[model samples]
Target chain A: MVELLAQTGLNAVYAASYISLVAVGLVLIFGVMGVVNFAHGELFMAGAYAVVALYADMHVPFFVAVAIGMAFVGLLGLLMEWALFRPLKDNPLGGLVASIGFLMILQSLAVMGFGVRMEHIPPVTQEVVRFTDKVGLPVARLYVIVAAVVFLSALWYFLKRTRFGWALRASAQDPEAAALQGISITQTARIAMFIGAALAGVAGALTAPLVSVNPHMGHSVIVTAFIVIIVGGVGSLEGAILASIAYAFVHTFVTTFWDGVLADIVGLSLMLIVLIVKPTGLFGSADRA
Target chain B: MRNFLILLVGLAALIALPHGLSFSQQEILVFLVINVLLVTSYRLLTLTGEWSLGHVVIMGVGAYSSALYTKELGVYVPVSMLLGAVTAALLAVLLSFPLFRMKGFYFLIGSFAAGEIIRLIWKRFREPFGGVRGISGIDPMPDFSVGFYQFDFFEPVSYYYFAGAIVIACLWILWRIEKSPVGLTFHAVHWQDKLAQASGVNLRAYRTLAFAIASGFAGLAGALQGHYVGTVNPNSFDIEVMVFVLTWAIVGGTATFYGPILGCIVLTVLNEIVLREMGLEQARPLIYGAIMILSILFLPNGLESLVQKATRRKTTAKPEEKAAT
Candidate 1:
């Protein structure tokens, strides 16, 4: 029982790692843009396809492909900022509807390019680290866990210790005040969008080999991200990370013990409970959410 | 008198419409009528300044309830459908307890989570909902002869007439609700809730009322869908359908009553007829997405703006715009 519990803890850690990556990016974009990006999951899918093309197809190094995936998806975010979010900045609803439109465009593009079927990515590594006969972590999965920690820590340092990070947060807090303080609102929004998009992309790229890569795969990822962000608090970064960890444990454990559908139900129920009890979330200030 | 004449002419045209269309086109018309109900009901919910991502799921709630009521409890299909709608409205009331705590983006996401839970419930239970495949072999609306036409369930035109009449009735009721003092209060709740509250408007109650009413109509639409299609699956009412409803509401512009209905008709024609004829089925979503993005950028006010521009009758357009947001 102890070994099983440890194994589940490790699984939850891995789950929390990638989930926080996606949730944090979602929080960042919402913080800066004040628009709910319905197309974010597609951006993650775009990252996975980046891996499929560069790493799996072109035979580039795995880490390099992951980097390209991150940058490429970030560029896509820049495109969205220029085209959709910028013009609809004042109209949050318009921005949201436009993102839904963009989601369709991305999904259809994927269907057209790769077909609707799942693309099997070759295993990047077959090695596993074992603590017991029945308890083991695959090296590929470990890569996702490690990358999430490194990228998230770097993001933490960037936000807290860097000048632009402060500017980003300032803009997120109050756009007009930030603008008066000599921060460019447009530039901050672009940077936030790019970084946000890159994080989701990198998470998708790292986990591509472990899951089925397909056009519709983003649907579940986006759902999970929404659950995490809502439970975490919409604009609070730390809340998102903590909520991601909490949700990962509950969801992974429930799925392990019961069923997948029930696990989804439980996760969504938890989000609803949070919204009812504390609409702002566990770590969120009431004003932000 | 002039308005009455226009109504008569419109009714005649609608009654005559299916005769000119092919069988498939007639079927599309039936679905379109049902969708007209869905989108218009969605507008009613938006009237309170909240857009719900789970409206489609609420529609599914009605579908499953009505389907099961008829299938399991041996209720009349029509009565069960009404009960289904009532069930949906009640469910909305229940959900509003938890959901109305959050406003704006939080409300949107909260509604989504509530909807997802409901959908997962349908997916998890196999006894009645039939799991992922959903409830199939649903009971159809029994055929009856109208004096002007012998209604046939097998033929799509007959169902079109039946659904058309029901939809017209629902729209009439919705129009009355919008025009009434209650509608003004809904608008008040939307535009300046705090001030309205100062003036004794129960903001929460009004919001919940609008949500319940909207869910009821959406449920009715779902029942219409189930009876016509003879199947009710979880996949049938997914986010894609909700996105379509949102697209119609946004692209057609929500400022006017006719906006979303107009959007529903035009987009349906474009998606079903124009794209289908061009033989670009696979590229349909791509083209549709492009249209959505382009229109949002250029026609932020929606197709209703164009209608207003062409008619040159500026009546209430400006005031309505303020109330719209």
Candidate 2:
């Protein structure tokens, strides 16, 4: 019984890794740009598709394909900003509406480029660290765990210690103030968009092998991301990461114990309960709320 | 008298539209009416500066509630529809307590989460909502004999008219609400909630009331849709549908009362005409996305603003020309 709980804990941690990557990016973009990029999940999808196109099809090295996928999707984010967001800067609703439109375009493009069928990618590693007969961790998943830790730690350091990172944080905390302090809102927005998109891309690329890759797969990810953001408070990055871990544990455990359908229900119910008790979320300050 | 005449003419045109078009076109019109009703309900909450993205889920609640009641309890269609709307409204009221405390983007996310919770409930409760496969063979509205004529809602034209009437009724109520003192207060709250509250407006009550009214209308639209479509699926109320409704409202212009109506009509027409011609299944969304982006960049107020601008330009030009002449 103890072993089973330990195994579930391990699984929860794995889920938390990728989920935080996606949620943190989502929160960062929202914090800086003040626009919810509804097409965010599609960017994640684009990353996975990059892997399918490069490594699965062309036989590129797995890590190289993942790198290429992250960069490519990050560029897509830059394009979105230039084409849609920058033009609609004054109107948050306009930016949001445009993102929704972009989401549809991406989904359709994916469908056109890759048929509706789920693309199968060969496993990057078959090696698993067995703790017991029924408990083991796949090396591929371990890569995700390690990548999340390193990237997130690096992100923390950059935000706390680096110059550009302070600029990013300052812009997010108060754009007008940051602008007055000589921080370029435009530059900060671009940086935020790129890093945010890249985070989502890396998460998608890393998890592509674990999940079914399809045109519409972004639908669920975006939904889950939204739930996490809401539970974390809309603008708090720390809240997003923490809430992602909490949500992932609850959802994954429920799925393992009961069913996927019920797990979704319980997950949403948890969101509602949190909202009812604390509308600003656990980490969201009243001012931010 | 002029306004009454316009209304009569509008009603007459709507009544005659189905007869002038093919069955498929009538089906499209029915769907358009559904979109119109849903969009109007969405606008109701937005009037108070509270945008509810999960409104499609309220519609889903209505759809599923009525669907299940009729399918399982064997309830009469009218009763089932009423129950559905009530349930959805109740849920909205229940959720508003928690949701209303959050402002702006937080509120939006809260409502969105609530909607997802509702969808999750439907998906989980297989016995009630039919799970993933969804509830099929929903009994259509039965025939009714009124003195000398029998009316059946099963026909596409009849369903269109029925749906259109509900839509018109909803629009009328919304129009009345928009013109009411409460509506003025809602606008005031939307523009500046702090000021409105300072001036003795109970912001919480008004916001909650707005959400309830909107959710109620969404439920009505959903119920009508279930009867019209004769099927209820959990997928119908997903985020994608919410995006479409939001797009319609945004494209039409959120500033005017008639924006959603115009948006629904234009998008529905474009979707029918252009989506059919493209042969590329994904082209419609791509084009839709392009249009939304361009519209947002160029016409922040929406397509209605364009018309308003054009009319104003003409009126201004006429005065200048008269002076010159």
The candidate that achieves the highest lDDT relative to the unseen native structure: 1
RMSD of each: 2.0, 3.2
**How does model 1 fare in lDDT?**
0.91
Highest DockQ model number: 1
lDDT per residue (tens digit) for residues B62-176 in model 1? 9999999999999999999999999999999999998898888889988988888888888889987899999989999998887878988999998998999999999999999
How high is each candidate's TM-score? 0.97, 0.94
DockQ of each model against the real complex? 0.80, 0.66
Structure candidate 2, residue pairs in collision:
none
Scored against the native two-chain complex, candidate 2 gets a DockQ of 0.66
Instruction: Kindly list the per-residue Cα lDDT of model 2 for residues B1-325, writing each as its tens digit.
Output: 9999998998898888888887788888888888888898888888988778789999988888898889889999978998999989998998887788677776777788778777777776778777777888898888776666456776788777667767788889988998999899888888888898999999999988888989998998999899878888878888878888888888898788888778878987988856775674567777888787777777777887766766767877643332210
lDDT of 2 at B237: 84
Q: Name the 10 consecutive residues with the lowest summed lDDT in model 2 chain A.
A: A280-289
